[model samples]
Target: MSAGGMGPTLDDRGARSLLRTIPVRKGPDLQWAPAEPPRRNAAMPDARTSGPTAGRKRDPLIEPRVFEAAVRVYARAGWGGFTFDAVAREAGVGKPALYRRWSGGEELLVSALHNLDFPTARDCGSVRADLLDYARQWVHWYRHPDRALAGRRISLDSRARPALAALYEEMINRPRTEAAREITRRAVARGELAPAVRSSTLPDLLVGAMSTHWESTPEGSRARLRRTFPAYAETLVDIILAGAQAMPPRP
Candidate 1:
């Protein structure tokens, strides 16, 4: 039924005539067209809706809801899986509200990682202890199964969309790297790390360990991780710690 009346009341010819009278202007279309059936942003990992502008409204997501939806998006679809529209849908709001601030899924993914609440080893006063705590926090955050799923999405999205990959590396991984570096630095200061150990390598060791751990024993993924992640993390950390001690002396 249409505003005019029951649509079936008109025959095919009459409907044709009505449609012919309607005009469509060839206005400029957006760069990205909505894909058929709209099966998530699986195509372009960077697929995003409009972003917040100068005069745009304040953030539509409140504290907990924003956090909650982000995790959902990451877990359900991964980093690339999250978009303003999806977030809006998850948050039960209009997509335009979320778009006003973030340009794409990458921005939203980065935001989620920042809110992960991983404790620093600095406060713990022992680098190794800090790492254990960091690992504990990492496990806790990822224990939800959603985090692991998000990690996988982010990894795949990184290859599909380089700009988005850069965003994740810069906004998310880099900070984690820096945090890990801080722990290594403390250990070095305490003479726990070999004199030859390079602080820069600290992040590499951790990243490698984490990547391997997540990639190998992914939870909530189509494939399960070969081994238990908790046990893996413990061993992985130990290996990195050993590698740090084995580094040839520098200067």
Candidate 2:
């Protein structure tokens, strides 16, 4: 792997294949829908309540609820509190049900993170606009109370939990890195970015900056950060694009 684990890995091909299956929104109107309201049932609810199970017969609606519960529990308690019993209680499901789906908490947490949605790269006319849209979307998600808490908790525990570190790279980072790579690749193809640009590192640079900003900013000042994030993201993109343009042509 390259610096910051940004370069393509052995699994890049497989990751791209999986990404193709995910829906990609086009144009410039990207927006995040609010999280689903939590359900009240103690157990898995019938699928018929929402719609016909039809093609989704194999997967229960409870699975998403369990995933959400697992994230909440893990976010609040970290690795020590991420127990099956805790998740079961948070999900209002039996421990046996969780055991049936996941062998342990590590597996449950990885699956939960993987189940979280990721938006695909879009061709929004220019690299600058595309990057701004992507950055804005990410900032919005990072500001979401539940996702922000979960992300911070996971980042903190990743150093001690090898399983979490690996799973996070495979399930979360790889796909996102690939998405960023695609944006850069498209920009280069369109002559918007210099061919000499080290496109692989773009994701790491952008994502790392966002994560660091989120973690380092005092909680009291986060509201201000949220309010100004769009302008901040735009400035960040401008710097990056300018640097890419300034790089000498690749030999």
Candidate 3:
């Protein structure tokens, strides 16, 4: 294990607290569509009377832009800040347009979560390699400037909000957890890991380590983090694998 490979020593509460340490920088917001002046009325402009493209039936980009905007807003501000007005302002659309599609922030946030691109881990030749691949993918995705701040915020923000927490489980946790479980199960089948190892908690450890690493690092140093991510990922995987391998078999 590398010098930094002390696998997450924090307990659940400590880890949760650490996850919230890094303040989410609002940063440059997502601006998929061109900005338009706010309209007093919540209703969107009639497609027929709108412009030269009036002949077209609908703006296909509207919902997509709205969805993207909703995510950005939720990521930056969490559940409280995730409002139709906020999404509308970000998406460059009228508030009523959002109301027309979704009933409330929870619904809109769910739709946004649905639209998010979830990363996956493929099976590599070895357990170590497989974990490294997953870790690398996890680091790359969450480290993105577009996602970094929002991802962390949403994670902590979900704790108190049952609805948000459920969405997090459905959209984020379940897939990643399943992938981790598969990796560990494959490892056991191939004799790479002992069956007695606490396989179930492995996902949380790996993800917690990654999240903690992100939270602890200074914002100014994240560019370096991105560049050095491969080495970090390798070390992280090795550390996790080493710990699992070291666990004594249960009688």
Q: What are the Cα lDDT values of the candidates?
A: 0.65, 0.76, 0.74
Q: Estimate each model's TM-score.
A: 0.58, 0.67, 0.66
| Candidate 3 C-alpha lDDT tens digits along 73-99 | 877777677778889999999887877
Candidate of highest lDDT: 2
Cα RMSD for predicted model 1:
18.6
Ranking by lDDT: 2, 3, 1
Better of 1 and 3 by lDDT: 3
Clashes of each: 5, 0, 0
Native-to-model Cα distance after best TM-score fit, residue 145 in candidate 3, in Å:
3.7
- Model 3 ranges off by over 4 Å: 1-60, 120-125
- Quote the positional error of residue 10 for candidate 3 in Å: 94
Model 3 misses residue 156 by how many Å? 3.4
- Model 2: runs farther than 4 Å from truth? 1-60, 118-125
